[model samples]
Target: MVDFQERDTKRGLREDQEAAHEGPAAEGDGAADEGAPPPGDGEAEIDEVRQQLEERPESDGGQKAHPDESAADPGDDGDHDDHGHEDHGHDHHHHEHDLDELGAAVVTVSSSRTLADDPSGDHVVEALVDAGHDVVTRELIPDDYDDVQHTVDSLVRRSDVDVVVTTGGTGVTPDDRTPEAVRPLFEKELPGFGELFRRYSYGEIGTRVVGTRATAGIIDGVPVFCFPGSTDAVQLGVEEIVVEEAPHLAGLAQRDADEE
Candidate 1:
């Protein structure tokens, strides 16, 4: 009877020990599984990082910026380019108002100079022609106020004469009556012309430019410019001022006629 009891007790103890070992092993396996990552977890993390990089903006140097950082506004860039084009178009349109070619009448008010010996008159004609202007007629006359006035009046009245240029009698001498005679015929006096002439001439002739009466006026829709008698003075006046502004002035002077 005692042997039977001891054998049963030993079997019970062995079963308890096995139960304790099996329970701990099962609990350990469950903990390891909970701590480990799921299948494809590493690939999923890599895909998420790549997507974030793609969403970020890139700089001009091709470096990616922060997600919250922004580049310049595209609309503002477009506006700047459009504004530059607008300013360029405005300047181009303003230049379109100038006449391409015009007819000019050249007169030399010198008692001693004939058409053949008129160096100033020749320079005037050459400069006008070189600038693509047509010389309708050229004349030489004395420095008398009546003759100067009459010749300029007749030239300005001509339909072919868009501008009249006189190269003589603009000095402070006694016979320098071009400005006095021509001033009476002017409907609109361009003081700026004389001012600019003297300003530019001061560089070449020094303060002697004060003695110069280079003048311009508008008469009967024609621009009349009076220059000094010397070849140097005529060259400066025609090349520097008249050739550059004549087309624009002539076009403006005849704008009413053109519109009509």
Candidate 2:
């Protein structure tokens, strides 16, 4: 019986030791859990990082979308033109007329320059022809006011002549009568022509443009441009102003006639 009692005591002590060991083990596990982040903390941190990456701009090399490039619109190849215009149509075109060519006559008015000696007149003809218009006739008339008047009158009356260009006598001098000769014949004065000529001439001759008497007007449904006798003046007038405006001017001049 004493032996039995000793066995029972040893068993109780062993069981108690085992219970103590198990309790400490559970407490150690709780302590380990305290060192770790709270529930959902790790997963929430990962989600926050993902959200930040999504919110960043694509320009910053992030997963965010580009402003110009859209995946929803499959036609967006990333080409954007700032100058896109409403439908391409001829009716809404800035320039009203579509005339491609015209018939032009060149008249040189100078006491000394015969048809053979007229460099300014020759330039006028060449420029007109090169711009896709036909120089149907050319004349070298003296600076006499009556002669200039008659020649321009005859040219404008011709059905084949769409425009008459006179070179010479377009100065403030006493012999300068081309503007005087031509001014009386205009049905309508194109004030802008003289203004633009002087503006462009100012670039070449500087302040000396003050003396230029260059002028233009429409007569009997024909456009007439009068230029100075100098080669430089003729060049600026023909190439810069006249060549670009001739077709449009001719179209506008003949519009009433065409309508009638």
Candidate 3:
């Protein structure tokens, strides 16, 4: 797969980032209970998320979403992505005119080493566009924990953005802390998301796919899905995961996110 910095440039975010939580999670829920990270949500939990959003150089006052400094490579074989999966189909199949009442965003994360022409990043943008949803913004941030957490909290708190599709940081490595970073902000973790993602990817790629740490959960009533750094992983994550389920999930999340 291409490096993380490379992916961020192509995979941008969706609009409506300004709307803060208007429904339940932000207002309905009582104080969040302290607990261990979700099932597969690993260690380095809180620290990694905070690290990513610290500061942006050159911009001085403009601390926009910072891209990763180093390029990202999953280290696993990238060849599997060459072939499309069997269960794959365009996610716009059942939506009402592609713009299904919800707004979305795409944020790619990595070290500062990303480049232009990122394949997976481009793929994410294309899929969201095809689905007819309004894509508002795109950003890059370092693989720091704080950055990831900030991004999640920022998007989720926004009332307009119904979902946030995040790529990278979903692994078990020392730096693979997507779950750890975002889990804390989640009022509830979507365990089935992790299981279903692994199952879907497994059928297509087989068991050699343990490196990914895919997950889904709610952050202040906003649905968030995190995927591995691979283009194939991102493909499956968005097409099979986000586009297909985002609408219903968004409504349910607003209503019963506590059960996510």
Candidate 4:
């Protein structure tokens, strides 16, 4: 009986030692490891996640964001990457910034009228403004070749305008020398713009759009979009291309400006 009691005491002591070997946290758990990760590990891991959140200004509660919201985000490819204008190492669907100019300025070409006169011109200005750009200046120059040319030159050379929206004088009339005038000043002629605009206008005016000389190009560090004398045409140009692409396109132009 004495021997049996001694054995029972030793067995109890062994169990006590095993219990002591395990951590206090695992006492209530079943089949836990003595080297198990500590209860504090979870808290410490959470702290690390919180620290990451603090370091990133754009991070909102560890959620991912789209590119348009924050330029700093690695996920944000940039706003100018719509037309794949430049090789950003990604296949873009639209034009990207080739210039650093983000905000835009407007210039409407008309005679005996200002931005307040032509509905087409007014709509163009409003479209640009609604798209979150500024209209630096507006004027009603006569549909004279020399006059239109001088106005455009002044805007681009002075670097006051990121974009110039000219209306009227884009027809087959004698005063329709906008192309001849502006063409000489363009550093890069965007033929696609005119082509696309006319293509869309084809459904409406059919071959009549052929007589229209709507065009777009880059001069100095500015982008110039010329539209027909119609509100519908200007609206189409702004809605389809300008509003969606200008934000990034201007940014690229502005980047170039900054470099200079």
Question: How would you encode candidate 4's per-residue C-alpha lDDT over 114-157 as one tens digit per residue?
Answer: 65567887787788777666777767778888998898888877
Instruction: Write the residue-wise lDDT of candidate 1 on 1-260 in tens digits.
Output: 12445654675586567656655446446443333345556457657767877886767687766779777786664544453344677777766768888899999999888998999999999999999999999999999999999999999989888899998899888998999999999999999999998888898999888999889999998999999998988898899999999888888888888888
The numbered model that scores best in lDDT is 1
Greater TM-score among 1 and 2 belongs to 1
Q: Tens digit of lDDT per residue, candidate 2, span 1-260?
A: 12445654676686567656655446446453333345556457657767887886656453655568755668877778765675667554745653577889999988987888889998999999899999999998888999999999999999899999999999988999999989999999999999999999899999999999899999998899999999999998999989999888888888877878
Score each candidate by Cα lDDT.
0.86, 0.85, 0.71, 0.73
Q: How many backbone overlaps does candidate 4 show? A: 20
lDDT of 3 by residue, 1-260 (tens): 22444433333221112122222234665654233123333324334544554532455465644665554577956566755565335543433333255677778888843537456667787888887777676666778899998988888777678888888888777887778898888887899988888988997789867777788888777788888878988888788878888877777667544445
Best-fitting candidate, measured by TM-score? 1
RMSD, candidate 1, Å? 13.0
The candidate, 2 or 3, that scores higher on lDDT is: 2
Using all chains and alpha carbons, the TM-scores for the candidates as numbered come to 0.69, 0.66, 0.58, 0.59
Candidate 2 achieves a global lDDT of 0.85
Clashes of each: 0, 0, 34, 20
Candidate 2: residue pairs that collide: none
Give the runs in model 1 whose Cα sits over 4 Å from its true position. Answer: 1-66, 69-82
TM-score of 3: 0.58
User: RMSD to native for every prediction?
Assistant: 13.0, 12.7, 45.7, 20.8
